[model samples]
Target: MQHLDDATRTELEAAAFRRLLHHLDEHKEVQNIDLMILADFCRNCLSKWLVAAADERGADLDYDAAREYVYGMPYAEWKAKYQQDATPEQTAAFEARQAEKREQKDA
Candidate 1:
């Protein structure tokens, strides 16, 4: 296996992260609720992670700024453009899955 230098590894990681953001932007039909229920993470999760990463580097990042980085725009603008009101059934299923996850974690 070829060894990557630190700079090369960092560049690759950054590129991969950018690709993920682009993928999420292109697939805006995938709702946060579905992501939470299935993957336990979503765009909001990505935003929070960005904030945490900034904090680790001693940079204070507000939620809106982090969200902009994750969503490729202001969160409200992204919502207005792509977010839909999840159906009641979808909400219920999400809650059920969350509850099940909590129970499993507690066991």
Candidate 2:
């Protein structure tokens, strides 16, 4: 908000992001493919963004650590516990989404 100081705004954003990670943790049934189709981003996307942000701030963070922070556990363990194979319909939707993104980028 324009009215808020920089430190306050950053604090609020960080808190909201933490809540979002918690929310995603609570909804493990929502697969990454569904997220990519609907929202163009997923938990893995968040992990990558975290790494980019850390790099910006000169911090040492790796993809695996960022993923663990987002996932509430190690990536492989989370995959074993909750990740599902994409259904045929989901795969089709994902392909369509990718094509649309490519078209937009080319345009």
Candidate 3:
């Protein structure tokens, strides 16, 4: 890996995060379940991470507020607008993936 200065790395990371958020916003058809099934994380996970990081810094950010920051609107509005019910195959795949992760962790 290239040795990046701290400031440069932080700026790049922030830019990448903004790009990811924009990409997700543009691809509203990609449901959260699909993200979870494929990546083992979703927008909600990002929200939680944001809240946790804030808490670590002695900030009092809540999940709902962090989710709004992540989703670019209230999570309920985003969900109602974009989220779809997962198909049986999607759910099964997600479950199998989770089980595999758990087994890997245990091993």
Candidate 4:
């Protein structure tokens, strides 16, 4: 990547991001709690990132718009169609991850 020209690198990055969205779109069964437990991020985090990126670039984007883009539909629609209630195990794992993150931050 360091050897790649900036424009080419950016293009590759964009391609990868698109592929990620497609992958997530395909994996609708993967719940947000699962993602949070494993990676500390979920679709909603991506939406927030999109909004922050837009703000940084002076592009007009709000949370709802970013969420729609990320979810490939309105978030409420996605939640109704696919989101699931977190199992007790998932909830425990997510809580543990949160505690670890806080410990690291404080350390």
Candidate 5:
């Protein structure tokens, strides 16, 4: 395995995070629910993680502000522009996926 210095690793991680945000911004058609169902995380999760990180560093950060940073705009505006209502099939599939995950965890 290639070893990286702490600073180098942190810089690379930040760059990757920026790329991920850019990719998500470009793919607005990818619904949050789909992300939650598939990856068990969504933009909201990223925003929450951001807040948690800031808190760990003793920096004050509001969830709404973090959400805006993650979403590249106010979340409400983004939702109005790109979000679609989930279909019944999507909800059912998401529920089934969650149950499967739960069973796997229990086993």
Candidate 6:
């Protein structure tokens, strides 16, 4: 990063981000709950981060629109096509992980 020019670094970062989005899109079978449980982030997290980034740059970005950008479709369409119901075990694990995170944050 230090060796690269600012423009080149920015371009590379943007390309990497796009590649990550493409990877997530290609792996649609990977559930959000599993991502949250395992990695503490998911597509919705990406959407929220996009919204925040836009706001920081003085751009307007609502939740659904940001979601559409991340999903490569309308949120509802993406959900219908790729989302699946989480199993009870997945739900429990996710809840437990979230609780642990909250506890760590509060400490």
- Give the best candidate by lDDT: 2
Cα lDDT of model 2 by residue, 1-107, tens digit: 99999999999999999999999999999999999999999999999999999999999999999999999999999999999999999999999999999999999
State model 3's lDDT.
0.91
lDDT values, one for every candidate? 0.90, 0.98, 0.91, 0.93, 0.94, 0.94
* Highest-TM-score candidate: 2
Q: lDDT tens digits, residues 1-107, model 6?
A: 79999999999999999999999989998999989999999999999999999999999999899899889999999998888899999999999998999999999
Order the candidates by lDDT, highest first — what do you get?
A: 2, 5, 6, 4, 3, 1
The residue-by-residue lDDT of candidate 4 on 1-103, one tens digit each, is 9999999999999999889899999999999888888888999999999999999999999999999988999999999999988888988899999999999
Task: List where candidate 1 sits over 4 angstroms from the true fold.
Answer: none
lDDT of 5: 0.94
1-107 per-residue lDDT for model 5 (tens digits): 15998889989999999999999999999999999888999999999999999999999999999999999999999999999999998899899989999999999
Tell me the lDDT of candidate 4: 0.93
**Winner on lDDT (2 vs 6):** 2
Native-to-model Cα distance after best TM-score fit, residue 23 in candidate 6, in Å: 0.3
Per-prediction TM-score = 0.88, 0.98, 0.92, 0.95, 0.93, 0.93
The digit string of per-residue lDDT tens for model 1 on 15-107 reads: 999999999888989999889878889999988998888889999898899899888999999999999998998899899998999999999
Which residue pairs collide in model 1, if any? none
> What TM value does model 5 have?
0.93
